[model samples]
Target: MFSSGDLEQAKTNFPEASSRDLKGKLLLPGFIDPHSHFGMMISAIGQANVAPPPAGTVTNFSDIIVALENYRDAFGIKLSEWIFAWGYDETQLAEGKHITKIELDKAFPNNPVYLQHVSGHMGVANSVALAQGGIDENTRDPIGGRIICFDDGKTPTGLVQEISMYYFAGKAIEEFQGKKAELFPKAQEHYLSFGVTRAQDGMTDLLSMAFFRSLAAEEKLDFDLVTLHGYASLKNDDLEFKTYKNGLKVQGIKLIGDGSRQGKTAYFTQPYLTSVFGCEKDCVGFPHGPQDELNRLIGLAYEKGIQIFVHGNGDAAIDMVIRAHEEESKRLGQPLDADRRPVVVHSQFVREDQLNKYRDYGMLPSFFTNHAFFWGDVHRENLEDERAFFLEPHS
Candidate 1:
């Protein structure tokens, strides 16, 4: 973590990349980010970055609008063209609140604008954008998603969560099919610049897999990438787990147990002290889907001989995953101590009991330590100080 040329060891070890744009940036050795989803970056290619500090320069709500406006003008986007942007974090804003559609409408009166939340679990859409997404006052919340509303409950507040967010993000990506066929060179170079050679995509949909395969055929994939296909989105169980091809591999099946904690959609045992955009009194967050569905999906993967990697950000969600594993083991009539190692990704708010259960079943745990550093302050405001302080406990 020193200045330019101060990392003499790195220069000497990888002399071949000495000329690949490592300037004044601090590069940590052996600091690999496992969840750098390359497919997401390709989908967001040529879009404005509105994330804070390290990712982008947007500090507040005002910066988001300005950045999008500039991007639209620079790209010569017509009023009829949809505006897409990513990396807007309400927690990092100076206002300490989520941006509203009112502000976006004022900025772009005719264009349909959508800003993706930093967590990738929620999004804010302008009124025009909402209409185009077929969301309206009469639109009901889907089984696994919610269309956050204003006080009236019927009218949307422009913010969509979970499954709802997926729809908007998917629609936006559909327009990027032209960009997906050709791998973006900078996408790989960006990670290389950070000295990260291997990364994993926790959730990969069918379309992304196709894009990955296309890039692999052309030898465009320049580094190792492991992707876990989304279980709910899987059309078949044909993926050969842990098999690599052209620097890319389909590692396993990913199941999302719940949403992000920072987004206040993480299922928890205790309720939040404050209210989220859609949740109020006694809000302990929610699961991404029903328990039976999760169990069925787990059983299906097990039958197909595919590995499972689930995302559980809260204690309740972790409980659900542990239960599913236990049930699956019982169904197979085999000892739980077998060599099978089901992964529990983002076991963020796991309790002591949950840890014991994980050990009892030999489930592998993947923690997000960055949560304590990046979102600790926000957690404190939303959760008990002790709970916030103990996030991603190393032990």
Candidate 2:
């Protein structure tokens, strides 16, 4: 290892040694984002942006409408074409309300509009969009999802949650496929601007995995890509673990235990302090599926020697995942594989007691600490004094 004196002497001797002058500045390694969805962000490049302050500053319903209208006009979008927008936050809106189907219809009478919520766990669709998806007032809510209704409980209010969000997102992505080649570079440029050298596509499906591989084969990607295939997507297919190809690699499998905390859908042991739009104060959020099913999936992944990255935001959901890990380890008659390193993504609401359990199970928690800065005050209002202070605790 060369010291500072040797480097200084070399700099003088070489004369042409190009280097940055970092006399008083602190230097650090390039940042790595372990939980970002690079592919999804890329696909959303051309979509209308309605995100609030710090992202786009679309603060109210009127702002969102104007943004969408401006996007439509700027692109000279056809009446038959769908208008897809991303990053609308109901909690941050001035009216503390979500845009309805009627509002979307009023804004774009001829075009179908789908506005995705900031949480990415829900979205609002206009009547045209609903009709396109074959969803109507008579349609029952899908499993682990809800179609928010009016006071009469018959007419849908346009907001769709959980699985329903996925259904609409799939349709939007299908439309986005035609423009992928053009948008991919834009997405990569956006990430590069933030100094991101390596990116992860957190929950990719089989089709997405293929697309990423194609990009790698064509030598289009400039940065390293690690993709975690969705567990559901691999159930019917006969796909095995793939190592590094170009700068791309199949990292692991992804499983979502619950939904978002801001959306009042993250499963919790206790009820939230205040009532949200659809859920009551007494309501504790529900899990995506039973614990046994999650356990089976975890066990199957472990047996196959594939790493699992579970999305568990709330304490209750974290508990369920931890239980599954414990059970699997016990059945195998040994501790978990340290190298595999099963991860609990967005472990925001983990409790004091759970820290020990995570250590015991050799589980790694990737906390979404950004929430502490962006939505801390909102969490305080929803969860009350005690729970709010403990959120994203340093200890």
Candidate 3:
């Protein structure tokens, strides 16, 4: 939609992944930060949509079974083949509970099912899916993840969190790879139709990043992919940090300090109003990794001069990120306000004191303000009034 001069300027400001050939299109559009998980969203375009109202009609467990059943029949899903569905939220359900192995076992005894949570941090797996992932009662939780179990604390309820859910998620992505030729164009069009020429593929694991690289090499990827390497994948020394290959770029490392606030897994200074699963009492939620590990990861990124994006929704988790930044700044003999431009993604429920620290540290607190409209009531029920009032903390 612009003249030659404007098109050239747009190329200078943004990655030219907009269209290898726009196939005779107009000028570029304004940039917007929608915080999309570009790669997975592309894959999920074909997955059964079990998201709540305005997206899907799933309101309860029975609705979930019916939706999955419809999808299974529509696709003629083979016996024991994986059945994947996205966007199920316990808070949105009538029962206000997680879909566990029991319900999934009854609905599809032979098929392996994986229901992705609305928050990408966790998911529910059927017994078949759990077995396929080799997760069971005896399986211990991964360092940065939890295997939510029943009240007995021994039997897994088939709800896996954080790093523990990688196996199933990775498998789903692998399946997407099988359909890339067909899905990639449609997926790219879906984003481009909204004038979204750029997108963030946050917290990408090693396997997914490799797959993206392969696509780039083959000239199959069409949009700018600004990726954040998952903290666990930071150990891969071969990654080309701060560089672009085709449209895919490894922008920085992402450290998931805690889970979503609505899920009651976020790390906060005060205890949650209600008790959560897997915690005995005073459930304030916990960090994905230990304190020392956080320090180590931040220090490593600092040493490499790699920008960081920390996912910290709760106040305590924000404190952890601030402390790590301070320790790293000291070791590097750099002031906190140096032009590193670190980002604190989803600074939800961030405290006023944390806001001061963020200013001093020259950090960008990317507040996802839509939570105020989407999960405001849940936050009120879970957090004190003062904390709920400060949600997103935009000036």
Candidate 4:
């Protein structure tokens, strides 16, 4: 579309410019996923698919049980071997209920079965799996987690929520040692196909970081990987940030302030319209810790010069993060560095006031807008029209 004189002038002005002729073609920029769990997604690919439509298409409770049993039988799994499955949702099932420990026990009496909730904040374990984890009725709940018990309040229903799933699911993952070398490359290829040149492993522990470092040493990766080291993994004083080979960098630290809203575990200022599975009315959910504890963690990360990404899906949780940032800024006698860009990940239920606070604190919100499409109807059911429509509001 340029005239001959204009083209000559452009070439004279920039001799280094190289031109590509494309009469008819489509061109776009590469996608950058700011917040995602690349390692976890790779692991899930190797596990059985039991999620509902689009992800797995397992529609009902019966379908889930059949899928797990089939996977176990096809793999010739021994009775002593553990069976782990992900992508199970109670709301999506035909029965409109969660699979209980009793049902899993009946299906796999010998094997220790662990079925993770689609929300990634909870999971269900059979009796054998519960026993293996030493999680009996007598065991107290962890700081930010809940062991959903039966009506008796003494008998665990095999459902674990929030931080409780971390321990049980973590032990299961330990069994799959050295899998990163095999799975990560495949995940990278899949990302490339989608035009994503840069990816983020939103949460990483020491073990995973060491594996990534080893991969870097071997020069196995082709794309860039940025990891946010989990707070739990940084408890040791010796561990510090370092850039490894193959463009892998430890960028910052991550903290989970609350759980998933779909799973009804995210802390909120008000209760849900309907009670959560295995929970009573007026259940406003819970936070991972008190304000003081959150303040301490944020302060520590700030002192270390690490950017913090706090996961706060509900308004109450976001409030905690805002308060912590404010306290830390005041304590340090300075405002947050805008260039560092502390983020509130998966901020699904933020209110109008919170947006102003975020601007005042120089904080960024990275919303999981996909929830608006995949789980919007379910959210409406739980929150009612008045509150649900306001979820992830852009204004």
Per-prediction count of colliding residue pairs? Answer: 0, 0, 3, 0
Candidate 1: the clashing residue pairs are none
Give the clashing residue pairs of candidate 2, or none. Answer: none
lDDT string, candidate 4, 1-395, tens digits: 33345777988877887887767987667787878888777777667788998888799877988999888888788987888888888888888877889999998899998988888899999999999988998987889999988898889899999888887778756855567667777888898898887788988866777887787777876777888877875566645564544778877789989998888989999998877866677888999889999999988887766788999988999999988888888897766544457899978888889888777767888857788778899899888787799888853
Q: Best candidate per TM-score, number?
A: 4
For residues 80-99, could you state the per-residue lDDT of candidate 3 as single tens digits? 88899999888889998898
Best by lDDT: 3
Model 2 CA lDDT for position 66: 97
TM-scores vs. true structure, each candidate = 0.89, 0.91, 0.88, 0.92
> Candidate 3 deviates by what RMSD?
4.7
Candidate RMSDs in order: 5.4, 3.1, 4.7, 3.2
Which of 1 and 4 is the better model by lDDT?
A: 4
Off by over 4 Å in 2: 1-27, 233-242, 336-339
What are the per-residue Cα lDDT tens digits for candidate 2 across 1-395? 23355776877777876788899998665567778888789778889999998988799889999999999999999996899998888888998878899888998888989998878888999988888877887988776777888877778888988887777899877888778788999888888888787789988866677788899999888888888887774464455465777888787889989888888888899898776556645677778788888998988888777889998888899999999988887887657534568888888888978877777667888757788778898889878778778886633
List the candidates ranked by TM-score, beginning with the highest. 4, 2, 1, 3
Residue 133 in model 2: lDDT? 79
lDDT of 2 at 150: 84
Please, what are the lDDT tens digits per residue for candidate 1 over residues 253-286? 8888988899898999899888777876789888
TM-score of 4: 0.92
Off by over 4 Å in 3: 1-28, 214-222
lDDT of 4 at 105: 91
